[model samples]
Target: MALFGLFRRKPHERLGFELYGAAVRAARQPVFFTELAVPDTLDGRFDLIGLQVALLIRRLHRDPDPRGPGIAQAVFDAMFADMDFNLREMGVGDMSIARRVKNMWEAFHGRAQAYEAPLQSGDGAALAEALARNVWRGALPADAAQPRRLAALALATDTSLAAQPLDALLRGEARFPALEEAPHDRDAGA
Candidate 1:
């Protein structure tokens, strides 16, 4: 028996990789940096990506389907794999890459957990404050409105993802809200 077989990834893993791609694209929207004033640094980019992925994971976990948790795990695995590749591309030493990736994983998990409470309670202000702390990285901006806008985006994403069909999500068709309009207005046709 072969210890490692060809095409080993289960179907959910492939769907997860595709879903991660969708999250990355959603996170890369220029409006986040230009209009919302999210810092354009690498850390800023990662923060946005984390937020988007966390939303997807949240949606997956809420599903009644039993495969939801497994799919979420696959999405997370795909994320770390991409991050490892990025680190390698940046010329990080092999000896330290694992450590750095671990740190990033912790940060992502921490922020995701922190954001969930406010989202569950439907407290926009709490969510905005959480965003300010994480996105701003402790140097709170003079313009409080920026983080609030980010929080709005996050909330809109939650609503948008919730509205998406579970089957669509399973097919890796998760769609973020349009930057040009509120989520409720955009999903009104659905």
Candidate 2:
């Protein structure tokens, strides 16, 4: 039982943080959807958003394209601000907020390969498009498209990369209370 402590968490949990962080770093543009788990009941909300951002950003980073780099980067930046605000509104605390955010990032990052693998093989468009519409369309559409379209537009427009180090930045440790020194009356020539 003692040895299990080192291997307790699932593989995804153990390395997801760094993996997600890397995905975030690799992106050349910001993603539009930065907030992960909102106060709602939806599946793949955050993961899909992250993947969409990654794919578009990855392409922009690799090859300098006119349409890909500029706007994509802007969107990614905006996503982060929105994410921070949303998280705060969700009533997250300083101590665990970073961990939660980072964990979610890692989970999405780890899952990115699954989402992206199909794109490489030209078989991912459907799933990709489905994920996109579900995430960005505001209202979840109820159409019988059978094999749904996983649109890449959301990926092309997300801005999650803008606000980073959210956990590190929000942690209470970063803001130690201002230190007060013993009162010394310099004006009185003490």
Candidate 3:
């Protein structure tokens, strides 16, 4: 049984891995660093990926499809698994990795809560403030445009996710709006 288990992954787990990869690809968009000014540091990267995952999870939660909850759990499991791998690669000791992962989970949940209300409300300023506080870690750029741009992207992402069918999302085929198509002004509205 153990050997068979090693060879066969649950379908949801496979889907989760695929979804995580999609989130990573979305987070790596060069526009985030070049135009949005999201820092290219480890935390910065994680935050972006986390945001993508959170948006997916949020959409799943609202979906009435029977598979929605299972897919959501799978995506969450994939995220923590990736966190574990990253921690080990960063040379964190096994004993400390668990604690660090726990902290990261807490942080991720906090961020989700922070962004959820504003995103749902379609309030651009509120979303910008949330992104500024969470993603930028309170070190908002002097120009103010960067956070606004990020907020616009977040709004677009939310809309894009909402447009995807639950079945497609459960199949790990998530899509986000192109950065070039992201809104540029607060008036653009979520």
All candidates: TM-score: 0.90, 0.40, 0.91
Clashes of each: 0, 23, 0
Position 26, candidate 3: lDDT: 91
Q: Which should have the higher lDDT, number 1 or number 2?
A: 1
Q: Each model's C-alpha lDDT? A: 0.83, 0.39, 0.84
Report the poorest 10 consecutive residues by lDDT, candidate 2.
172-181
Candidate 1: residue 60 lDDT (0-100): 88
Runs with alpha carbons beyond 4 Å of true place in candidate 1: 5-7, 141-143, 183-190
lDDT, residue 150, candidate 3: 78
lDDT of 1 by residue, 1-190 (tens): 4657664776588888999999999999998888777889989999999999999999889888898888888889899999999999999999999999999999999999999987777666777777888888856652366676677678888888888988898878999875665433123221
Query: Ten consecutive residues with minimal summed lDDT in candidate 1?
Result: 181-190
Question: Which stretches in model 2 have alpha-carbon errors above 4 Å?
Answer: 1-44, 65-78, 125-148, 151-190
Note each model's CA RMSD in angstroms: 3.9, 19.6, 2.3
- Per-residue CA lDDT of model 3 for 42-154, tens digit only, reads 88998999989998888878888877778888889999999999899999999999899999999999999999998989887887888888778889942388778777888
* Residue 142 C-alpha lDDT in model 2: 20
Give candidate 1's error at residue 7 in angstroms.
6.1
| Candidate number with greatest lDDT | 3
